[model samples]
Target: MGRWRPPAEKKSKYITATGYKRMNDELKYLWKVKRPEVTQAVKEAAAQGDRSENAEYIYGKKQLREIDRRVRYLSKRLDDITVVDRIPDDQGTVFFGAWVTIADEEDNEQRYRIVGPDEIEASGQLISVDSPLARQLLKKQVGDEVYLQKPDGSEIWYEVIAIEYEPY
Candidate 1:
């Protein structure tokens, strides 16, 4: 198997206190409650029959393995991760946690919020701050043009329309 981890990326300094608590709570639940439950399930399934042909036993083992895998991942990840709670000083540009609106050359408008990797949601266009598009947008202000390299041998350009971090 390939190596399980890469060098940790710097996290954004933009998550709210509530967001931090949510992450911590999830980690605690996985370690204390879910891990033990899955372990007990695996033990019970293993006791039921021969290991070679038992479907329940096989699936139970897989479940245990996945749980253990996540537990190890969370332990390592949480240690290296620094929760980003302080909002950025610059509010006029597209900074971490800022909701930005952009208009393409074709006049199609899009909205995105630059967020930390762990908290990003594709559905909301909540992109990670480390993403190429976000990187290109870092310090640009209204009406400034930003271009992003795409995998399809072409680039896309967007004109910054607005940036905001206040109450929506």
Candidate 2:
């Protein structure tokens, strides 16, 4: 069976100043260090001959392809990104770059930074602003109830505990 998925995530042109800097740094590191290192490895592997049977060659080539793909994606993303350098005037509503705390029906507290899809990372509870949950949370204020209609004919309920634009 195929896995379920939301539509392709679309990111806003505006990113927080810190987010922009992190993306820029990643792109720079990939191009200046990782890209060249992978290219060199691929070349070295190729020089050994018999690439069809060469595991190193195959892996190097695959890694290089993946790196190049990301490099290109970051290039386009950076160009499109606006880099929201200043905070917005809205304080009561949840929007892009907002830090939100919510409690589910189970009384489990969750904190997440709503950010562009390109900025998501596992280290932090970062939710893509374009996600279904984020979409429901957007424009909502503290004390507002949000109900997410899931695919399994069930709904998840959450109440906004706090919504602040400050970056964490």
Candidate 3:
């Protein structure tokens, strides 16, 4: 059986100032604090001898590998990102960093902050710029209707209710 896979599409390089700072802070913490602590633990575990039977040594190695992987990803992503701190001249229209309110056919209003892929948090309603819904909302002004074709081949409609951008 073949294991070939298609290449992933490129993500937009735009990032809000807050998102940029957060990513940098994570990179700094991983490199200066977490990496060193993990390294020390691995060293101590290795010193205990009989590595094949040493559970602590194996766990330490695995943990170090995961940390290193994250560090590399953060470093590369930071290099590619462009910090967008300026508000668009036309604030009425949707753009990056805009907090947008959208209403569906049933009048259910959903609020989302369009942010960089790296800044998406589990607790917040932040959508990536590369997302299909975000792409449809970009450059759209209040009262403009958006029709999105779902993966299941169904079309859903939404109307832009409001747009706001906070100063960075």
Candidate 4:
């Protein structure tokens, strides 16, 4: 088999104000603080005799490449994204940046914030707007039910119990 792979699907460009700020902050830190520090380390390492066997020089160069890659990606993403700073007029409906609380038939509830793909967190509280759950929840008002079919062929339903624009 070849090492070739298909291109990834394009991600949505809508980002909340907080998420945009976070991305910008990361870009700035990587470009301003981190890059200069690594450059200096690499320079010092290069000055010390032979570079072929110099572990510090090789490691520093690798770190520089990774940092530059991230910086470039963040810069382009920031320029392309649209920042959603204001809350929507319809507070009762699920929309971007809204904190939605959903409940299953058993009354088990979970809260999630609809954010851009870049802002999806490991905490599970933030979900990308392009996600299946968020797509079904969009424009849905409180008391509305959302149906989703899992990849495993199981079906589940969730009722929108509450929707808030502000973070809790």
Candidate 5:
């Protein structure tokens, strides 16, 4: 099979203000602090001569390439994203940046905050707006039922218990 793959589908451009700031801070740190430190190390390694066998020099160059790639991606993404700083007028309804509490039929309760794709963290509390669950939760209010179809073909239902804009 050919190595070529189709391009990924574009993600939503909406981002919470905190998420945007976090990305901006990362870009600045990589460009100003991390990049300079790595560059200095590479320069020192090169001065030692015989770069072909120099592990430090080769590693530093690879690090620089990775940093540059990340910087480029962050710069372009920041320019394209829209920061959502204001709370929606309808606080009772689910929307971007809203923390929603949901309960299953068995009375198991779970909470999640709907955020932009860039802000989806390893923490399970945050869900991307592009996610199937978030899509179903959008515009839903308390006492509303949401149905989500899992990849395994099992469907589950959840009831909206609460929705809040402020972070706990």
Candidate 6:
């Protein structure tokens, strides 16, 4: 088999101001604080004789690689990101950085915040602006019905209940 794969498609460059700031802060911390500490640790580990059998050296090298990878990604992303700081003129409609509440056909309400991909956290109800749901929600007003076709071939419908852009 060929050890090759197609390159991934480019994502949207739009980002919320808060997301931009958070990513910038993370990049700064990684480059200025974490990188130095890890580099120092790796240097210390290298001084402990043969690296082949040195567990600390191996672990430090792996950790350094991971941190460097993240730093590089953040650098490139920050350069391309366009920060959206102001709220949309139409508060009644969904747009980037809007907190949206949607109700399914069964009357179950779900809330999500549309944000840049970099700002997505596992603990929050944040959705990527490029996501299917977010794409459908954009420019949609309250009481509008949205029909979303899932990747699995099933379709789902949602009604916009509320939309707002608030400071986080």
Candidate 4: list runs displaced more than 4 Å.
1-3
Worst 10 residues of 2 by lDDT: 8-17
Assess every candidate by TM-score: 0.80, 0.80, 0.94, 0.96, 0.96, 0.92
What is the C-alpha lDDT profile of model 5 across 60-103, one tens digit per residue? Answer: 99999999999999999999999999988889999999999999
Q: Kindly list the per-residue Cα lDDT of model 1 for residues 1-168, writing each as its tens digit.
A: 987898776765445444567677887998899878877887887788788888877887787788778778767766666665556677787766677899998999999887777777649678888788888988889989998878998989999999988542
lDDT string, candidate 6, 1-168, tens digits: 997989987888988888888899999999999989989998999998999999998999999999999999999999998998997777998989999999998999999999988788997699999888999999999999999998899999999999988864
lDDT of 3 by residue, 21-104 (tens): 988999999999998998999899999999998999999999889999999999999999899999999999999999999999
After superposing candidate 2, which stretches have Cα over 4 Å from the reference? 1-9, 49-53
- What is candidate 4's lDDT per residue for 1-168, written digit by digit as tens? 899989989999999988988999999999999999999999999999799999999999999999999999999999999998888877988889999999998999999999999999899999999999999999999999999999999999999999999742
Candidate 1 vs. true structure, TM-score: 0.80
Could you tell me the C-alpha RMSD of candidate 6 in Å?
Answer: 1.7
Task: Please give the distance, in angstroms, between residue 19's alpha carbon in candidate 6 and its true position after superposition.
Answer: 1.0
Of 2 and 5, the candidate ahead on lDDT is 5
Clashes counted in candidate 5 amount to 0
Local error of candidate 1 at residue 143 (angstroms): 2.0
By summed lDDT, the worst window of 10 consecutive residues in model 1 runs over: 11-20
Q: Record all residue pairs in model 3 with backbone atoms less than 3 Å apart, i.e. clashing.
A: none
lDDT of each: 0.78, 0.86, 0.93, 0.94, 0.96, 0.91
Clashing pairs in 6: none
Residue 14 miss distance in model 2 (angstroms): 3.5
- Flag clash pairs in model 5: none
Candidate 5 whole-model C-alpha lDDT, 0 to 1: 0.96
Clashes of 6: 0
lDDT of 2 by residue, 34-118 (tens): 9899889989989999999999999988988898899899899899887766566888888778889999998999999888777
Best by lDDT: 5
In candidate 2, how many Å is residue 110 off? 1.6
